[model samples]
Target: MSARSEPNEPGARAPQSRTGGGGAGARKDPGWWGAPPAGKGGGGAGVPEQKAAGDPRTPKRLPPGGQRGGPPWMGAAMPAEKSMNFGPSARRLLGRLRPHRLQLVTIITLGVSSVAAAVVGPKILGRATDIIFTGVIGHQLPAGSTLDQAVAGARAAGNDNLADMLARMDVVPGVGIDFDALGRVLLLALGLYLAASLLSWWQGWLLNGVVQRTVLRLRADVEDKLNRLPLPYFDRQPRGELLSRVTNDIDNISQTLSQTLSQLLTSVLTVVGVLAMMFWISPVLALVALVAVPLSVIVTRLIAKRSQRRFIAQWRHTGELNGQIEEAYTGHELVKVFGRQREVEAAFAAKNEELFQASFGAQFISGIIMPAMMFVGNLSYVAIAVVGGLRVASGTMSLGDVQAFIQYSRQFTQPLTQVASMANLLQSGVASAERVFAVLDAEEQTPDRVASARVDGRVEFEHVSFRYKPDKPLIDDLSLVAEPGHTVAIVGPTGAGKTTLVNLIMRFYELDAGRITLDRQDISTMTRTELRGRIGMVLQDTWLFGGTIRDNIAYGRPGAGEEEILAAARATFVDRFVRSLPDGYDTVINEEGSNVSAGEKQLITIARAFLAEPSLLILDEATSSVDTRTEVLLQRAMAALRSDRTSFVIAHRLSTIRDADLILMMEHGRIVEQGTHEELLAAGGAYHDLYHSQFTAAASVDAEPEPAAR
Candidate 1:
């Protein structure tokens, strides 16, 4: 049965309208990365106009992440602003590590055991100090003097304080150093330190594994999320920004876990162990050291609070700057041809300056943390030293105990300082985590039905309505049917929704109202994978990855035989050009496929589609880049491929679709006329006018007089 148009459509004079860039006419509008049109306050939006190709000022397209713009990793560090809810984001980040809980527990145990062994070393050394000091004092006294005699001698000299201190010392008068006890004490201290070192090393190794595995899982989730997200979500976001989240933000999270997680655990453990030993040796001195805790906290919080905002700006600007630089470099030729180099540079300078200021502020503020912490620690040290000396002289504490207490005081404050210093990395990492989490939390495409049906060549759009924006309708209550084994050609003005029609058929976007079916079965009920698997598409934008020509062709059907690959190549005229190259079918396409001409690339894509042998085919300006001769050959090849299969061809050049079984002339998203090419021309409607306008223009170009020989 022949397709029919809606009855409400006008017979002549198509309406003037504009949709998004989906239409060919909308090509004049700003690109996705660009501002809106001029009338909507989009002019002079700092983006330059695209210039014509081959201008002398136009620069050659540079390879992405090539020497010209450094590697992608060297782009501004992809940082994010502070998370809106830091606590929840941090918890979520930690949750990523839950899978490695056993390893984490082992690491924590090692950290605690290491701290306990390390904290004991100082106390043991203090015991050795006591032995040396007691022997020295004893050696200075008279030979064979008794304890009572020493006390009497000090009393005779009116040194009662010395008498009391001497009474507390358990040293024999005139005895020299006890080498045996000192040796044992030194050996014990060394053993304790050695144990501590070994445990800490083991802890570090385990932590590294845990962190990597967690990050690996996180990266996988991000990759899966991107695949599941709807196409419209991608359209609304910047490509560079999305890339930053995937690469840079995930990297930051990994680094944060590696550097801070272990350190934080160890530092807290050290603080607890050291504090306990300090009180055990001298509670009075422990109290004195505790005085610094509140002060240090205040200093850290003040500096961190001020720097947090700067860190947020610093990372936010970093992502923005990276995006801008990427866009500018990608379109470097366009910027140069339009003489917008200065404008591009000026814009870059502004973003660069903002990044610099933010980085400087964040660093400058956070940098003050260590010094402030040291100041507080130093004050506590001085007080402990003075009070310890007085207590030792009064015989309330031994010189060995005082020495141990001072060492414990330093250890106690040092860990607190270390914790304070981690504030910067912690904040930056959490911010990055939030960005990654945002992607994971984004809405995904609707899930497929539990059961899927097979598709044949027939497809039908039933009372379909759709829109890009809520206020502006692109395709309204449109209905069409494509029977089995027929070619349906769609032709319209640029914004007449030609591309949108094909997109809807592919289910790239969902309908606001109505249903589409395949062989009388609703397409929405099938899994996307199953639905897309049955269709082969040759797009205008040819994409050839970095691989051999043979490999690229085989991509359509992963296990396709060599003979099948060659046959498809021959059918699409790809084999001829490929054979002339040095390597024939084995010729390698570069990463950007710059090694091939535009027409050759188009042929390669067509060959790939041919290899698929799909039930349905879609060719959207697939032959537009090729010369007239090549186009004619490709049409014949496509005709063979289209035999006994449904094909949808969207084209602007009228000559290519004259033999189509069905021709639909669309205007303002409605199908105003549908008939065979001859029928449409005979009706003298919108298609009639469009067909003459293109040929008339082409005829005038061909009729121009030849120029005189120079």
Candidate 2:
């Protein structure tokens, strides 16, 4: 589904806010619209001030040149990026061809045949040279052309040998020409080129089919790998960075296969075939050309090795810039609030400049290979011409052989330049392939065997210890139990590990120690499908995909009928505002339901949860964003839904969870107190202090006049 956005086109007026019944239609600013770029800091208070790349300490900062840097977002707590082994990664990429062995074998067969046919061109052209030469040798009569003039001049100078050499013709008075041999040689050369071209076309057609199939499987594997990987893997890496690996990296590999792979095969064949023809024609000339071969190799190797780093840097900068765009564009509103638009743009420009420099260095450095190869080739050509001319003067070599040797030399040297360019492309392709393989080889979550008996709403966390990282243990040796059909409200200050506890219950993160069981079964023992199927979560974010309201509501149970969906909506109080809209339940929601108010989107999520009717319900700050009046309505609706299920509520607004059956007052990573609201208020502990602090603060804010700026 396409993301719905308001028209910011030129001349378009800004949208007006609807201030209607119960003030529910009043416009509200969405605090943050997107996740931050994933990096080491985890989007905490300070983002390490966006350092430049190259400095290792600043994990996600762009250093001065923006050559290469870590993921900019700290939203995902992904593991630190690791360097890859090129050889193994390339081997793994080649192994993908194992599945399409037949097609590959055919393409290679066609390539070999095409090259063999192509090789005949230089040799056959040389044969045509011999024919033309023999036709002209030792016979003179056709006098008008340069060769005729040369012979006339030689005869005038009284040089019989020079005259015979210049006029090497064997035409009889009546028969005149040996057109038969000349025609056959030229026609044969044309036929060979035509055949070679046709064979290459067939090979390319087959190779394209093979490339598409291989890339298709590679893309599928990357997608499947995402599902198998643990949530932690996604935490520290930006989605954009991973997207670059799956799409841009894989696409690079496919392109190389289509372009470089065939060129590589043809270059090797052309080089070998040309050398054979050269040696057959003249060994001494062949030796002169061979000397340039090593020079070309050394020059190409030196430049390619240096260029490889720049190519890697080019891709690295690309991933970083992609992450920057995603974060900045998606979270445009947050940047506006902070007034960091200029800063964001500056960071982007710096990263873009780095990417440009890296690409320039990679391309410019490798680009020199062709010119360098051509220079060496020309030197060899000069040496061959000089040596062949000397041999011809000594009567040891014919003009035709010398001419053929020069042609063969050009063919041999041409592929070396082609090979040089392909080598550079191959290096870039291999770098991309390694990134793709890195994603494929990432650690996967252990497979679960679903025990298909039954699960009650009873949940128990026994001495469970867990942490995002070893340095800071978020939850430690915690024990809790919620019997079937009970309301467990977890109340705490921000960063009190409230959401972390919810994550543990849902098994989104594995426990560091101990066990969490549902009924008598360990939650980890069941497949995530079976376990999560019974649990319903409505986070504060209230995410909504781009679709009709009906589609979004029915996402809880995709095949649910209209009546059931409407019933769920009515039960959750979503039907109240939904009916006020002209389109009713069919009203289109934008990405994240931006078209609707925050409270409205929240109610829709409640309706979805109502439809699911899960055995366990988790609400993490489900009502924190709503007004006091709307909160009352939602609380009433939630009470009805919680009638026959075990529900866990994490709330910052103490008033909302006041009536919860049991309130666990938490601080740090443990529950400091647990009781009913009234019981806690009477006890005068952390819960009492927190309840007073929230209400007292609200009361003071209401009484105060205009406040001064911080």
lDDT against the true structure, each candidate: 0.75, 0.70
lDDT for position 334 in model 2: 73
Query: Which residues of candidate 1, in runs, are more than 4 Å off?
Result: 1-83, 698-710
Model 2 agreement with the true structure over 471-568: per-residue lDDT tens digits: 87667888988889999999887767777777777766788899999997898888887888788888775567668888888988768999999999
lDDT of 1 by residue, 1-710 (tens): 00111222111111111111000000011111011111111111122221111101111233355433432222333333444566888998998888888998899899888888888878898898889999998898888889889988998999988888888998889997999999999988888888887888899889899999999999998989988887666554544556656766677677667767876787788778888888888888888999999999899999988887776676567556655665566557677777777766766787789977887777678767878887898999999999999998988888888888888887777777766766777776787788788899999988888455766788899999988788888789999999998999999987788777777777777889999988998988988888888888887766676689999899888899999999999999998899899989888887556789999998998999899998889888889999999999999999999998899998888889988999999998999999999999999999999999998888999999999899
TM per prediction: 0.87, 0.83
- How many angstroms is residue 451 displaced in model 1 relative to the true structure, after the best TM-score fit? 4.2
lDDT of 2 at 177: 39
Highest TM-score scorer = 1
